[model samples]
Target: MRTLIRGMLEFLRMTVLLLFFMGIIGQLENSVVKMIIGREGYDGFRFGGNFMFLIGDLLLFMVFYRNYLQFRGWYTEEAERLPKRVTRMMLGFGFACILLPITIALIL
Candidate 1:
């Protein structure tokens, strides 16, 4: 448990930056969509909606990278990679919170 906490702490910096950049990208995407559609609301993408989708893309990338690193046996010390596990859990939680709503919005 301590290791997990440590791993997460170590990974937090990168994650925070990624979230910030993703937010900007999300806002950008939303702006473009709003401009094209010339409106806002459910019919067009908003910052929060686009942010969730960007986060989904990031989560997919992280998952794939973790698997690739694990498979490649590139780590000198496996403990250093423990954060990847925590990030996976984070990804799951994020998807549940963000992606799920997006999905429901798309469907209904």
Candidate 2:
């Protein structure tokens, strides 16, 4: 029962994180594009939606990998630290969040 409850909580937490990421990235992208192109008649390709979708895909991968680890008995309360590669990916995502929107805005 405890494990089931914990799993549910983790799933909810990850879902919330995914939504937050999508919203933040989408809004930042929209704001940047509007600012760069003067909010005028610019109806070009929108990268923000693509990026948000990518975030969802990435979250799915994370959840699947976590489930695999749990099944293998590798994920436990004592092994709470995330892998370094995941941390780096998150850092890269953060950097891209700032850089990609500006680049896309300038290009469009």
TM-score against truth, every candidate: 0.38, 0.50
Model 2: weakest 10-residue lDDT segment is: 66-75
Number of backbone clashes in candidate 2: 0
Judge candidate 1 at residue 7 and give its lDDT. Answer: 60
Residue-wise C-alpha lDDT for candidate 1, range 1-97, written one tens digit per residue: 7667656754674466557757675676556545554555335434466556656657655664455443443232462343766876967865664
Best by TM-score: 2
lDDT of 2 at 61: 43
**Please, what is the whole-model Cα lDDT of each candidate in the order they appear?**
0.56, 0.57
**Model 2 per-residue lDDT tens digits across residues 1-108:** 888787677667656766775677557656765777667322553777456435544654454445444444422564354577875676566556555645675675
- Model 2 TM-score? 0.50
